[model samples]
Target: MTGIPKTYQRIVLAARPRGPVAPENFRLETLDVPELADGEVLIRNHYLSLDPYMRGRMSSAKSYASSQPLDQTMIGGTAGQVVASRNDYYRVGEFVGGMLGWADMGVSDGVLLRKLDTTRIPLSTYLGVVGMPGMAAWYGFNQILEAGAGDTVVVSAAAGAVGSVVGQLARLRGCRVVGIAGGPEKCEYVVKQLGFHACVDYKAGNLEADLAAATPDGVDAIFENVGGACLDASLARTNAFARVALCGLIAGFNGQEMPIKNSRLLLLNRVTLRGFIITEHMEFWQQGLQELAVLVANHQIKYRETVAEGLAAAPQAFMGLLQGHNFGKQLVKLI
Candidate 1:
């Protein structure tokens, strides 16, 4: 970075969003890069991750995390290379991953950054299947859902990054896996590519009927990512002594309030529903990542990505992600 440009590009939250995020909610700007202090490193970001969880940060809601400040660089996961380093632990030119936000370059004190090995998998994958999303799936499905052989496991938003891994891992454990996705194309990918027993198209307008037809044995476990009608349908089809991983409520993230319509089923089915945030379960992450890395490296677990080119594309790409447009992991390429 001796002769590198002194400025960096970034996007910030222009205003707090009231409902569905519009392009107006974000602002793009450039600023001169600051000189690094001791124990700090300068990162030239190559990829920025777009996820449904970002929507929660835009609002001042009582969520698992605190609200992101307005008019600041929006919070997000990023993978990049260290262009300059004052930290002895990390060397320059080494790829790293951290929560560096939506920027072409960022500075860090090495507290949150992790060194990445691009020789094993694609560098961008650190933001997807081999990273946080994959850990979420592993912890949510194994520890929470607890589905085993002869059981039927159903996952909502099952074609996205986390859900894709959850269904595939359930299948590996010999469970009958069913996926709930938005469109016919995603449903096809969920069943054909991910090897789920069946996939129900929720956007097809017959969620209850489609789910019922897919899981005739009644859902023995659920790894729920989407809420609202998708959750309602799963609750209706759950079996006795079933377990559920209430991972995320993507359908209600944008201020849509959807009340559960079938509370009676919880009592009748003896279901166990637990909500979790992956960060809170850091104890399991190292083991989970090691296993997930092997699965990903050996192609035992498959994933897809819908990459949006450039940092400016992040805002629109994120809006599309909330609406279920991305195929697998939604990532913005900042190279």
Candidate 2:
């Protein structure tokens, strides 16, 4: 990339969203794909991941992770083939996944962008199953909550990326699984496709009643994704010494504040809650990727993604993810 492009597609934060993100908050424009130096690689993005955590990145406030700069390209996970390389760690034609953001072209030093082994799975799979979400489920189950067979597991946002896999993995472990999603369709998919014993829809109302019916025996483990009312509902059914794997808070992604009733439920139940971003244990990334490959090869796991075509639709698709409008793992296809 001696002489890079004068303009490239990018999604920028025009303004901090007060509530739900609107089209006005994001402004898409063209910018230069910076020239790569020695030991750097230039990648033409073929796919970009849209996760719920991205919503918090738009704000300028201090968070668990650093916030994205205003009027700059939105931060996101992406997968693409390397087009230019100057490092031995990466070579041209190799696919990679990392924080490439929403851009048509990206230049990185391979520090953040890890070289992906495309031989094991599809390039897009790197963004879902074998990527961050996969690592998230592994960490949440194996390390954080430490789930096991005979445990009753409940997962919120169970049709989404990490939650979906967590629910299914619990089922494979012989644990009773209950999923909480948004609507009838997603709830049905969670039970039918992900192999959950039952699925509850928060949008259908009476969260307490639905959650009670779903896990009548009391929930022993919780793979938490959506917070707020859903969190409250889960707390109501938690058994003694319940382990809660705090994954994400997509419930607040819409910028709406959620109220948690009776904070004593955690203290009363002796619940052990562990919050994580999945990157905390980068050491387990390889382990997760390898294990997921075995599962995929053995036909023990299933996955899905909602791909949005074109770079221009990236912002809208991203917003759609925050609203639970996306059916599965959301991705933007560039080429």
Give the runs in model 2 whose Cα sits over 4 Å from its true position.
Answer: 1-7
Question: Candidate 2's residue-wise lDDT over 204-261, tens digit each?
Answer: 8878898999888898998989888888889899999999888888777756778779
Candidate 1: which stretches are off by over 4 Å? Answer: none
In candidate 2, residue 59 scores what lDDT?
80
**Candidate lDDT (C-alpha), each:** 0.92, 0.85
Least well predicted 10-residue stretch by lDDT in candidate 1: 1-10
* TM per prediction: 0.99, 0.94
Per-residue error for 257 in candidate 2, Å, reads: 3.2
Find the candidate with the highest lDDT and give its number. Answer: 1
- lDDT at residue 185 of model 1 (Cα atoms): 97
lDDT of 1 by residue, 94-146 (tens): 99999999999999999999999888789988899989999999999889888
Q: Model 2: clashing residue pairs?
A: 8-31
